[model samples]
Target: MKLYYHPLSGHSHRARLFLNLIGAQHELVEVDLMAGAHKKPEFLALNPFGQVPVLDDNGTVVTDSNAILVYVAKKLKLTDWLPDDPVASAAVQKWLSVAAGQIAYGPAAARLITVFGAGFKPEEVITRAHAVLAVIEAQLSGGSFMVAASPTVADVALYSYIARAPEGNVDLQAYPNVRAWLARIEALPGFVEFRKTPVGLAA
Candidate 1:
């Protein structure tokens, strides 16, 4: 399997993290987003949306970060990462929605502003980040992982951006439970660090 990705992208990191956590053997193909490589004809053939983190599992192609997670977990029959039970599946799906929705516009968008010079309003996205973090804080107060006692795809979906929320100037100090949960995820074997942005540089 080959993962086409950009190092600074949290979405890319999310997919890459899961692969490593599961001990999957894969190759990384870095896409030069700065050089407009993702928009070129060769890359577009893989994903019309022209996005990074496209997974090529031999002949199978998976687009979108969350979709990649689902594809991998189901293909590997990893029920711990993606539950088979209906109610548990729904619970996991709920957080996956949050990862794509609130987490995207909230913390991720705010970080894009600082790291990529994106056009979102700082105050708006930063406020949104805090609001979502508060809910996650409350939810995690009762458990170590989201949706269950063990980690799930939902945890991987939410991990990257929340772990680096401070890069967006969104404070994590207020959410103790959330911080501890982050630590738990970090301590897991086979964990990989999401590349951090330099103090005065944008990747």
Candidate 2:
């Protein structure tokens, strides 16, 4: 298996964390997002969206992070991340939807725009981020984990971006439950430390 990714991308980080959680060995291929490597013909051919976090398992390529999570969770851990009952699975879908929709757009993208020169109004983005965080805070107040009592794909999906919200100047002060959840996630074995927002390349 080959993972084409950028280190700073939260989506890519989720995939990496999931892979690590399951102890799946794979070669890491860093794609230079700064150099427009993802937008180039070669990379676009691999994923039409020209996105990072493309997993090429032999000849099989998975582009979307959520899809890759489902594939990996089902294949690797079996019963751990994915639920069997239809109602329980629907419950999981709720968080997954929030992860891709609210979490991705507001918090994750806001952080990228602020940190990576993606160009967006800071106040506007931060406001949107807070709204997303509010939802998570409410959810965290009720459960030990976002989607389940135990960690699930939904938790893995949102953990990186939510934990790194401070990089976007999005305040976590109001959401103590979420902060606690972040700490819990960090304490989990195989959780790799991620560089939240690298303003510039390190020497």
Top of the candidates by TM-score = 1
TM-score for each predicted model, relative to the true structure: 0.97, 0.93
TM-score of 1: 0.97
| Count of residue pairs whose backbone atoms collide, per candidate | 0, 0
Give the residue spans of candidate 1 off by over 4 A: 199-203
TM-score quality measure for candidate 2: 0.93
In model 2, which regions exceed 4 Å deviation?
198-203
Could you give candidate 2's per-residue lDDT for residues 92-198 as a string of tens digits? 78888888988877777678776787777777777888998888889889888877788888888888888888877777889999999999888888888666554
Q: Tens digits of per-residue lDDT for model 1 on 10-45?
A: 999999999999999999999999999999999999
Of candidate 2, the 10-residue stretch with the lowest lDDT total is 194-203
Residue 109's lDDT in candidate 2: 69
